[model samples]
Target: MSEAHEARISRNEEDIQDIWKVVEDIKKVLAARPPLWCTFLLMALSSGLTGFIVRAFS
Candidate 1:
């Protein structure tokens, strides 16, 4: 193949490798205790507000 075609292929490969590295890092991060804590906090707050609204309506 031509030089330009080879360079383009190399660049595409680099981009794909970089993306995979980023995705792996994100998986590691999310495997830690972050999403669980955030999800629990959101659910607790929503349920608290729902209870208050139910009491107010009743």
Candidate 2:
């Protein structure tokens, strides 16, 4: 293969590796956070309360 083509391929590989590293770092950060169930539970409770209030007032 031509030298320029080989160089481009090498750079592309490095770029791909860099992207994977960023993705792995992001995965680690997200894994360290608490689960989302609490948020969902709060949302559900709020919606239920709002619905109850609306119904009672109507």
Candidate 3:
């Protein structure tokens, strides 16, 4: 194989490894966070606000 072609392939492999390391680090950080029940609270608040706006405009 030509030297330039081999160099290009080596650089590509290094880039893929760097990308995987970044993904693994993000996964670890997300796994360490505690789960919360905030979605339901937000949904209820949004629904109430929509109803209020509709009633005020009617």
CA lDDT, every prediction? 0.93, 0.89, 0.85
Over the stretch 18-55, how does candidate 2's per-residue lDDT look in tens digits? 99999999788667763675576689999999999999
Candidate 1's C-alpha runs over 4 A off are 37-58
lDDT of 2: 0.89
Model 2 off-target regions past 4 Å? 34-58
The backbone clash count of each candidate, in order, is: 0, 0, 0
lDDT for each residue of candidate 3 in 1-58, tens digit (9 for 90 to 100): 9999999999999999999999998777666753433555578899999999999999
* Candidate 2: 10-residue stretch with minimal lDDT: 29-38
lDDT of 1 by residue, 1-58 (tens): 9999999999999999999999999778777878786798799999999999999999
* Candidate 1: C-alpha lDDT: 0.93
- TM-scores of all models? 0.59, 0.59, 0.58
Highest lDDT model number: 1
Give the least accurate 10-residue stretch of model 3, judged by summed lDDT: 32-41
